[model samples]
Target chain A: MNAEAAQPYRLVVVSGGTSDPSSTRMLADRIADRVASLAEARDEKVAVSVIDLRELANEIATALVSQLMGPKMTRAIELLGAADAIVASAPVYKAAPSGLFSSFFHVLDNDLLIAKPVVLAATAGTARHALVVDEQMRSLFAYLRTMTVPTSVFAATEDWNSRELGERIDRAAVELLLLVESGFAEKVRTESWKSYQHEYGSAGGTELDIDLSTDLMRLATGGSAAPRRKP
Target chain B: MQFGVFSVSDITRDPVSGTTPSEAERIDAIVKIAVKAEEVGLDVFAIGEHHNPPFFSSSPTTLLAHIAALTERLIVTTATTLITTNDPVRLAEEYAMLQHLSKGRMDLMLGRGNTAPVYPWFGQDIRQGLPLALENYNLLHRLWREDVVDWEGEFRTPLQGFTSTPRPLDDTPPFVWHGSIRTPEIAEQAAFYGNGFFANHIFWPSSHSKRLIDFYRRRFEHYGHGTQAQAVVGLGGQAYIAKRSQDAVKEFRPYFDEAPVYGNGPSMEEFTKGTPLTVGSPQEVIDKTLTFQETFGDYQRQLFLLDHAGMPLGMVLDQLELLGGEVVPVLRKELAARRDPGAAEAPTHASLVAAKYGDAPARQPRPNANRGDNVTGGSPYQDGDAQAEYPSLG
Candidate 1:
């Protein structure tokens, strides 16, 4: 076991459902519960935290327009920054994930979730939109460089009652549990963080490392950007 | 501490009046505004540069030189002169002339402009903005200090034995303040040169500005310029003050709602709470401005964004009265009392000249007769060392 394996794994759930008792949040919670019980069966502890996008709807819109982070939005970023793994669920509108879900991720720093494990799940009214999870949502997390599990959970009205839905959730839960147990995210951050591109104050304001030895930094300190002339 | 007012030179429509001022009218009004700033005893008046319509002051030095001629004891400056697109050679020449015209009563802050299209208009790529700003400033720094420069850089053509005319007022370069919202490299550049770092403390939360300012202070000390406490810092503030807090809020709400940069976004109350914008009575403005010292340490200058959002000249003049007459006097006393003993004073022409030449006379550079070629040759100035070597043309 690694140093991180001694502590309870922190699993964060982000739900982009808009209504009370939303199916999107329910799907996320079901996956989170399955992951928790699966970890417990292996004699490991799991701590789960939920980020309801409905609560942050206004804040997300405000951030989209003004680049200002509200208190709730700031807290949500803090939780995600500390999370070991994430379960992201959204209600499909038209043929894609809800704007609230996409906007929330859009406001996050590009490097915030580097190498972090995630379980992408989505709910739609029809089976026709089932591919939204893998096609659209996965690409967004991919751009963020998250380590999304191979098994993505998708639920339509019909699938919610089908037994295979639960089986897929179980498969995703175990995949995430194994990834979290391996400490891939922690290792990448600890060992290879400098290899990734980062902006100053990015990664939820935690990426503050500045490399002062670059060519631009040399120019900043009065050295010329041009090649030195031969004597 | 120095107290001043800065404008973005935005010709916004008055949401309350439902009218927009003509560019000519706004231009005339800004001159009146700067005159009133000094009339009411404010120390500085700054104007911003923009190339687009609905923004008038594309030529900051032209406008500032006029303002300096109109008012006495009021230092005129740019809120930010673009360092990315404008050639460093032109900036060195024009600002030196302005320094001479104003008799060392002018200084400027540098910023990479936000408008992307403006870059291509001047044969630049916005993607290269940061490097361009850093490199151009590197050249501009040499032009004012060194009489003859032989330079090569990435963005601009190389300079050979080039001398920028007018050489700065009494051989003193106008003090510079680097304005940045988030870029640490900008702060590093500012600290590397011992220049002031000005945070546009109006748009973002104070924490953002605090992080940048703290980094600047550390690097300033690292560069051995001074102790962290003695690094010069400037903050931008926004306020709408009245006899009562409620009246202030009521009067400013329409303008705040329809203003261009942040309109249709956060509510006035929310923005006021989140950023350094204060809409309250004179005492409240004074109280909130004082907290800036606590947050960023004792700093040198505080500039307020007073005349934007289509605010009429009459209303802006009233704000200047409440600011210069009521708010600034109290703030001056309070900030002076709270300042750290080791903190540096705001840079001025007299002080910089005194620092450069303690008892000796300042160097007055007189150019040798032109050789008709572009080259000024080595020892271009009469006072320059004659023994300096140059390749023989033989």
Candidate 2:
């Protein structure tokens, strides 16, 4: 079933961090809940799937590089690929983002994110590393050609206790909802230097769109999705 | 050159005055510190993976995928992705998807985790942990490079025929840096594959890390990756910098004394004297870190455990500023001066993957060979002729 069957807007929550009842995961939940609530308020049907990467870490990792997808991860990957918008949250590790989270992204294809919209948020102590959302996370979004909502919410530990957090999260969620309703707020058009066709008359460009749905069938039969890149 | 910050995921009491931040507060604090690392300009950001209590992240990949949608230029990597317990097949696919999501800004370091009990919980025996890592990684390597594989291995069931999904963006697998502290076996594994070797050299002095890295470099050459100098190496370190050395030590002492990992052993002076830990001025850190090369020879990546020791997020950010503004430029210059003209510069995600499994450069595959049977006689089975059934072993 597609999102249209379940709901028009789906919120996919990515909770990244170790399993110590992290505030980062809480932050992810808060944003997700807020988004769900907002969707309900607007009388819009929305589906929410919380993928605690910790639970599926083993299978997901094994499935990714080897192209072995368990039923659960396959469902999760499909949701992630088809989601209209996403709210991603992680606790900062070191001065950047968590390595576990990076590992998860490493297995994804750049084409999966083309023209998708995303909302980025992070949790940290004090106000020291708040800018990581823009400096680090947003940069990755830009590279993947995803449309990131402008207003990101970065909450410090102190901000959590403050009443302002709910309002802030709600505001970010509302902004994302607005974008989801409106479609791409900013149109990003990459400057293509050249375009051509292969000897077999296959149209190719710096970025080309092929029917992966058919490729998926071939992969199912061959039991492999490995690219034909020579080592 | 490498720059990164790692988190300990702890909320500790201020040793001077018992003030323990709630777990919630500690987690939020870590998030901010990571964002700040990027703002100040750092190359890579890595987070540790732990399954037990006190360590918040059991799912580093999910977190990383989220972070991938967040960052731009910074290369995201794991300080340690547990290779012992985690299934290599999943590791392969998840990271490939991440590479796609991040637009090629992803890579990781493989390590056998510190904890022991984590093994059995995952239905694995800690006794066979090293074997699992070795065998699993070998499979993972093949999964990334090969399009279709008929693989059978000890740990996982046989794959009559298999291909991972969500093909890699650049058709390149993420670069891997095998991280180890004292294990020469891990070094050998890394060297055998021509992968980078990282010494999370926090506990030991440069001399100790040097022995392991040298072993890896030598073995790497033996395996035909390149010369010893051409082998990629990364080091892990710890530091707390203040303008004044006295103040730096004074402020960090309590946390050091109470840290779950470091609090138990040697006296502060003794620990500082022998280990890579440095609690002093920015200049002192630079001086000590630069000496790493003298001891270990030319290295590639350098990451520090700054967010650990239960230090507050505010103080950690201050350290990052100094690191970005004061430390990085000087270290870059000094390392550049000392670089071996013959040795390749440190490999970034782009460089490493290209060197390993990049798109076919000269020997390109013929375009429509698989489409028609005219050339090599296509498989007897057409696209949908049958399910391509494999007989049951039982």
Candidate 3:
């Protein structure tokens, strides 16, 4: 039996780098592994898929723009959409993410990221461009309406000294796992709210503990925990 | 078996007497060269997209769409599709439409691009290039995979309940090859998605190209796409071929001296020795290219740069015929026979799209329900308040 049966979460790591023993990939793997462990602690089986964008770099543009979606791209996009929470890492290039990473994103439509929670990470040669996750990545995700985890991790060349990289990876893993745990916990509460919606109309009084329609309506709008007063 | 041609679309002076081809003539030459490439039975034909001067293919999709209509089996690709400058939303919809029109003979090479001036020409800042490529591609990937999308990102306006259409024929998207001569990030991006890596191995040595592709292949398997051998690989080359080795060298030397990219660079022999550029007979070019396989490993496609330096149309046509008829067949068989069973074949538009799904139309099943854009005429949603909510942006 899988752990966290009461509430399940899917963890996806999207890594963009072209080295076998890559720091960014190690970061992505650690993030995924940590999230899965947290989910397991709660009796939930965390499903994970790591997508390496380099392997599909060639057809990205045509596949995205073409009227006929290719099979490989379709499968990749499906995996992206099914994730409950995501940890995305890319090596910095020309002061931001690589063209290939962005090309993969450019090929996808906007609807795939609605209300998704993402933890962003970046690897760069120097600390001068470490803020790319915030300056560039934040701006991009903001447009997609994805709820980015407030904390972003940026690692420069100096951050990794063999031993330090392992520790940093561990730290990032913990951070990502915490984010996933919180995200899934929120999902469970929402599910419960949906179940309770049917019970709302039965109450003759307006003193119900939960107004399900209002909660759902709030979620559909900005997906914030706060209730929205309809105009 | 690795033979491909790239069109730079430059109107250069004919070095001997100092006369240049008109832009129109250069563009016309592009078409003729592609036709010749097909006739020569090359593996692929790639046309670059450039908005600035000295280059004519601004709209690659438009040109490729035309190329698809003209040719039967040539694997048409973009030498460089600016991943940083273009919007992913429109990029997705437009390509989907093109896929239907082309019947699967389309793929693209993504690059951040070289001309920094072109960035502002398209209302983008070159400073934000890396971020733009990252965010925009994330959204584009989703558009292709998901039936409907609601996204918001930094680079473009938010998409609310959006679905890019027409859908890819058979719900399969084209294969992607990340073309890069320098950046390791591009290679990483290709690996991240299990896509192909094309080290435009034109100017560089086999050693440099090897490192970049090897980097990509390693990450590809590390991310669990497949083994390193299954990673799709392509490369670009430049060559001048003739019947005899000395004759080829003597003829191409003048053109090489006058070449814009290499004009001030090393001598012809020195340059060709280090790079993939070969000035030799058909057999010599074959020998040089075949040796690349041992260095780069089994690659899928090998595209060559043939039509440059104002080489006469008649002479260029002759080179293609010699390359296609005399050399390609032998190399193709040799490469195929040597490839391991564990290796994955090159993924072209027709083959990959067909293998994944099928040859089909590039239209969505229900175009009306979520006709987000390009739904102005004959849309059922045109009735009443629905139109107000989703105005016909067309």
Native interface contact recovery, all models: 0.56, 0.00, 0.00
**lDDT per residue (tens digit) for residues A1-231 in model 2:** 334434567778877757769787888888878877887787776677777777767645544434333445556667776677787787787777776666566555555556666778888776898898889988877866677877787888889888888887888888888777765522322332122221110111123232224433233122233355552
Error of 1 at B9 (Å): 0.7
**Chain B TM (all candidates):** 0.97, 0.88, 0.90
lDDT of each: 0.92, 0.71, 0.71
Worst 10 residues of 1 chain B by lDDT: B385-394
Q: Candidate 1, clashing residue pairs? A: none
Q: i-RMS, every candidate?
A: 1.2, 20.4, 20.6
Model 2 lDDT per residue over B1-394, tens place: 7787776555566666667777678666766776677788887778888887777767777767776676777777787888878887788888888887877877888988889999998889998776677667777777776545456555678764455544455556678888876555667768778888998887655765676787789878988989999898988888888889999889888878777765754556756776788889889999998989888878888888887666767888899998888887789899889988867676765675567566654222222225453322222222212122355677
Best by lDDT: 1
Candidate 1's residue-wise lDDT over B1-394, tens digit each? 8999999999999888889999999999999999999999899999998899889989999999999999889989888999999999999999999999999999999999777889999999999999999999999998998888878788989877778888998889999999998888889999999999999898888888899899999999999999999899999999998989999999999999888888788888878888999999999999899889989999999999989999999999999999999999999999988878999999999989999999889888888888898577777788886332445677
Model 1, DockQ value?
0.69
CA shift of B175, model 3, Å? 1.3
**Between candidates 1 and 3, which one is better according to lDDT?**
1
**DockQ of the candidate models in sequence:** 0.69, 0.01, 0.01
Question: Could you tell me the fnat of model 2?
Answer: 0.00
RMSD of each: 1.8, 25.9, 18.7
In model 2, the Cα lDDT at residue B60 comes to 75
lDDT, residue B236, model 3: 84
Candidate 3 ranges with C-alpha deviation above 4 Å: A1-231, B353-364, B369-394
Candidate 2's C-alpha runs over 4 A off are A1-231, B11-24, B353-394
